[model samples]
Target: MLKKRMINLLATGFYTGLSPIAPGTVGTIAALIFALVWIQKYTISFAFILIFVCGGTLISQWAEELYGVKDASQIVIDEWAGFFIAVFGLGVDKFLLAFILFRIFDIFKPPPIRNLQKFHGGIGIMLDDILAGLMANILLRVALNFF
Candidate 1:
């Protein structure tokens, strides 16, 4: 059972959902690594963004069922998807800014973000992050332009 659980968590990206230290941090790092590696060759960031969004949705739903829990902390695919949105194509050179923005959006869940979470199944799991990501992107864009 323990081995199986570990496999499940690893498959879900290190049980990042259950991380006490910094779940978002773990998820963001995972997402960044993916972006750097998989998206390195792609000139268009939009393609990467779409892939993350769609893939994250399917993976999140699978993790939800595997974990037999809704919004399980061990499932960080949502975080991965969310982080991508927050940092994708913002032209922010600084990693610190991306980190801050991703965390803020994940935690705050402003407006439609909170509303999106009310959705059922994998879509609900994914949509909330999408909203949060969009909010973070908008905020980050504004901040970058200002500063």
Candidate 2:
């Protein structure tokens, strides 16, 4: 019981995923606040993203079993991981743009990003958002170069 509860907590991004609407966005907002407050260095942010990706995989897989749904909406750890990646190495001033871009990429899942969802289990859950974050990061970098 304790293990399940803990998994639930983490997998749900400390229950931010339990929001009645737009749980993934809520989870991303929680992640953004967390990044703003606690993540000071790019190295630290990268480390957390790695941890979230690896741990998120296991916890998300377990969460799917618990919820009896594949990639359930309540599993928003992926969003947390992705949002962190989207803002990776970006300064505070750029986080809002990163957030917006990440949301767009995540929602639309353009090109290969959408294709990643065909994977099964935890990888399937994590890959799409990971790609979305990477895309957002890349686009943000390009946009910054122009301005």
Each candidate structure's TM-score, on Cα atoms with residue i matched to residue i, is 0.79, 0.95
Q: Give the TM-score of candidate 1.
A: 0.79
The CA lDDT of each predicted structure is 0.70, 0.90
Query: What is the C-alpha local distance difference test score of candidate 1?
Result: 0.70
Candidate 2, position 1, lDDT: 100
- What is every candidate's alpha-carbon RMSD to the true fold? 3.4, 1.4
Candidate 2, run of 10 with poorest lDDT: 39-48
- Model 2 misplacement above 4 A: 40-43
